[model samples]
Target: MALPRVSALRASVRAQLSAQCYHRTFHGSSARTGRNRASVLVAGGAALVAGLIAGASRIQRAEMTGARVPTALDGKDLESRCSCFMAPPVTPLEGLRSPDMKSRMELLIMETQAEVCRALAEVDGGASFIVDRWQREEGGGGISCVLQDGKVFEKAGVNVSVVHGFLSEESIRQMKSRGKSLKTKDGKLPFSAMGVSSVIHPKNPHVPTIHFNYRYFEIEEADGNKQWWFGGGTDLTPTYLNQEDIVHFHQTLKEACDQHSPTFYPKFKKWCDDYFFIKHRGESRGVGGIFFDDLDSPSKEELFKFVQSCAKAVVPCYVPIVEKHKNDSFTPEEKLWQQLRRGRYVEFNLVYDRGTKFGLATPGSRIESILMSLPLTARWEYMYTPPANSKEGEILKVLREPKDWVH
Candidate 1:
């Protein structure tokens, strides 16, 4: 290679890198200040841009001078930074070489899982998560963290999984039915899915139960092209209706979504209500939060940033409710109602949840992790019903008719 061409190569690298990095910035701002939050975002963006430019310049100079160099953004450096992860990443360093969205998504979920567990433990005070790392015989693995019977929380499970294998014929048919343009040579497609999923059921019926999952999925098409998309959502399931707490949850989620696109919140909120419905009972699983799937629109980078906003919104959305109500006194009847509501949660997950059914049907899937979302306690009396004009009846009415909580 001639020395003159080095300048051209450096320019090309800079252009490519800028294309990928420039679109990224902090996703959301505090809704209170009419978003002077933009100023903070711009400052952060400026810092990131400067750092990226300096690193590229350093690497270019090093190449020309034949000098050794290392960077914090390199995969090796990043692996060290992510040392706090519950388990080693699914993809080896070599396999994760260059244009590294796959590895970045993996790290994001790991970070989310860690953060959620820490926040819950801090609030619980007397309990910490028990981390369980396990591997799938066919492909990848996961870490499941559980904190059970805590002072505040009853049962909490926060899990991160990275798995890759061939999708079965039944799965293929299911995807195709959803309007996915997919084909299988021998009725199988090479696929990978990674995500952070959590279910937090508090001891007091006053503190609502929260559930969320954020995931990225990819499939290797028969033509050697890769097809990828993002999915997952967060929702609230309260034994007793508290309008203020529910409003706070919805508002936080709306703020996050609005930062991405004005349309995202409303569209996904409706999707959440519709998706979580227990068809047999003709009522929603919960008061709805944002739910979206098969999202491969606008651009990959933009969508990734949007997902990050939603993931970060989880803590702000649910933790305040926990702190406020953790010590609130409850009657035995209230506890009984909570258990009965949990029975509905179990029914929805077992019979209606696509994720649960998919995990159950998949070969070599970890059953314990799939079922970890179940609460420690649930009850179903034979055709039991809440009394007329009772508080429980009010909850049933709201569940049957979802509300626009944010507005």
Candidate 2:
């Protein structure tokens, strides 16, 4: 089935909100005393204002847009003009072709979050997601949907964010170090980023934990040049070895890739294996699926379609496996093993995961949303070992030595 057109939905929501709201942009400035200050109205709420303040670091010294104002507008006016209550639509990039890539990608991710969460709720049959809507101070916000202690899933979270802001020189340098060629006249880059990220931890040890994220990023340069790229992948982590499940997972991802490019599956599968490797432990994080970054190729339209294809494939690839093993019986010992494995998952995220690091470092990042990928529970047993021939041991072998699941 085709994904929902969230762009239209977004427009509809904006129309509803517009009738009840007016525009007020909070401008931030760094005074001569080197103290950062922002003119903000508290009409919406403290939390909304706080998010904008946290994100205010991106405003440059000279780019302050509005005059300082202390008090919020009186009563009804204050309530009407606050920008904090609603997420502003992303400003469309000028000179771009027919379909606005920024809007298109953002809608796709938002809709995917809704689709995935709905499907997961149906599969869980007992728990529904609680949605948290938050706005970024800079420009935009997101919805974080989470379900905990479900019949099928122990903890699952799917979050979608659309944010645009100026990138500091330090941030640009970091990206350049990672092979991103970003340039700006005033030593700062204006950027827009949007994506859907999810991680699922099933109640049954037989059901593997799965994660997937797809994102689109654009950086505008000083010379009026704009550079854009796409990045994403999915991977599986299981406590017990099941070749059929692993094979099906890889094959499903491969079919998605093949529809876009014959080389995508193989290339990205290897990339996933490399990207998710826990270098210190000398092991792969999971049976790799597909991962690719900095993808700007045939055309924006083509890449957008390719990304949509991959997003659509996620449900089919994972739901069946959850259905097959979610009811399977397991022992306390098996549950313990899963906890230990989750410990490794924690190690990788805290130590080596770029997303975790980036989110932590980002000025306006929501800590709760960023860390939502972590499992509800985890354990570390010093010098623990499983029987050499046990199911847990078998899975460890594949993790230690990554496999070609679809071969």
Candidate 3:
């Protein structure tokens, strides 16, 4: 009975072991399938994550390289690494490969001021110009050099300025009224101007007082368009008329203008006469030189060359005249006449001179430099008339009527 019971127990144990083996095989296959599905899900997640990272990297690269970086107006780089807050980068016009006009004009004007001051100093012999360098809070700055009580010149000023800032609404409206092509989104307009202007007053009444100015102006629009121009002239005002001196002066300017264009002299000469006319006094300001504005056609290089020619001709045009009459003797009456003529100059500048108006209207302009063109002393007399057919009378006649000195 014990043997029979042991056999039955062994059979039962074998059946149990077989059942356990079959369950293990079947569950193992199901577990393997689940693990494979988990691996596929993980691989898909990793790929999705990689794609997201790649897209983010591309966006960051586009932000860095797609837009133009900003730079300071003075061409200096800003300290910050993030360029989004930087000043607008200088954008040249499409297909324009030349240097920036404002920068070029600034360099040219500064060089011209230095050269002119040096030459005038040599001619002065007794005094040298005192340079006053100043800056504007708005955008730019200038150099003002003045000489007083000199051997050849009583008072002289040579000033060079490079300014950039926003134009007032009134200024924009005025400019638009003058037929300037301007497009402003807001009332304000961005503008840049660079110029060199000089005024020379001689002690000797016989020597003439001369004025010269050359400038470049640019208006930048909201749509990245630019409007640029060149304007300038040189004139002579003598207390005593000297035919040879006046003729030489006009001829020098004519030659300079002719080098650029034959039409420029005649057109600009007439323009000068018309512009400098003292409408109230019904007389011309002085013996006319060449004057022109809105000169932008025929290419910027040509205009630049023309302006350079005019500037270079200045020393030759007036220096010899100064040297010639600087030693001449004059009476107190002649000196008084010179003062009266200066009064007329003051009137013209204060009333009708566009340069003076612009300078005074510009924000942060240096008043001293703007008014430096005025004589150190001026006199206004009531009903003053020169003796008929006298030296003063001859000059008055010329001033009252414009003449073609070169022809």
Candidate 4:
């Protein structure tokens, strides 16, 4: 059984309650005294709140009882489903592979993917590409790229996404209570869709892992479809925070955000802080960059333009950063510490991530790729303590309480 999208669930429940209240008040209106109208209105409003609370409680109970909520598909199932989609056309990965490829940005994506892949391959041995695509059981589909074993990065791949689908607002709300919410909407779940990319773990401590994604979504209404937006950003994580590397990473990302809007850097930086938070630890995964989810008000075309801007910035933001550290040597001790930190990363994914749950629920998903974010090694020392005020402890402090980098 899988959980519902929390925001949609909440919105659905709220909408239902609102409808019930409106119906009761209008129906119960008195012809004689205007006072009766007010009375009914008050009662109806109270009933709406009561109904929402009751509905939420019921859903929670059903889920706790493991009342089988049909899952779309898990990771392994998704892989097989996606492979079937690709069997017919043996299009080489080098060309335009996405459906909406007529745009100039799409052309650039082709060149970027090729050039980036070439650069990455040269840095380390060529990455074994794990590419797959599938129609989402929810509404749309997307493609994922995963590269393992590299000279600069231990493992890294940028997952590009394209999707469109519907999730009830009530479902989204329930998902949040369960800590699975991402950048989704409030009110009734809009007829929504998105494209995204996210990278998991990197091998070298010096290489610093990174994650970036950009997507667009829209909401539909009874009168007319309304509201569309673009969202996503890049962030950097290092086992050791080299001041220069941190500066370079943020500066590059700031340039990207600034190019779109001056307000973007601060707004998205805060969003990243909030979005990438490891809720269990009450801290962020690393020094923040720009991260935003549901960005609406902008026209779809405008959103796409912003998406292209962000996407184009990715290679510049990260490849150079990787180039700087790919050759840095590390001792076995440093490698071991890197693995230890990976345990925290795993905890965030398994225990709190929406992606993990979604993948587990989706049929025919690929477990290995879903879990590829996991480090090659990990450690958990029983009741271990680090020396106070040491560099090791400095990193630990930031992990304990996330820092605001741009601020």
lDDT minimum window of 10 residues, candidate 4: 57-66
Model 4: per-residue Cα lDDT over 1-407, one tens digit each: 12233334334433432232111112242233421112121121111112212222111111111122222334332222222121111122322234342222233333234334434544555444444443445544444444555444566554433344455544455445655434544444444444445564667776677776555545555446455555567777778867666666666667656655788778887777776778776667777778876555455545555656566555555655566666678888788777767776777768865565655554434465467566666787666566767656777777666665544
RMSD in Å for model 3: 34.4
Candidate 4 wrongly placed segments (more than 4 Å):
1-116, 135-140, 164-171, 174-192, 219-227, 354-370, 400-407
- Model 3 steric clash pairs: none
Error of 1 at 169 (Å): 1.7
lDDT of each: 0.74, 0.70, 0.68, 0.50
TM-score for each of the candidates: 0.81, 0.76, 0.75, 0.63
* CA shift of 359, model 4, Å: 5.1
For residues 216-322, what per-residue lDDT tens digits would candidate 3 score against the true structure? 98888989898989999888888778888888788877877887789998999999999998999999889889888878899876787788778766766777677
Best by TM-score: 1
TM-score (C-alpha) between model 3 and the true structure: 0.75
Give the distance in Å from residue 380's predicted Cα in candidate 3 to where it truly belongs.
0.6
Model 3 regions lying over 4 Å from their true place: 1-98
The RMSD (Cα, Å) of candidate 1 is 14.8
lDDT of 3: 0.68
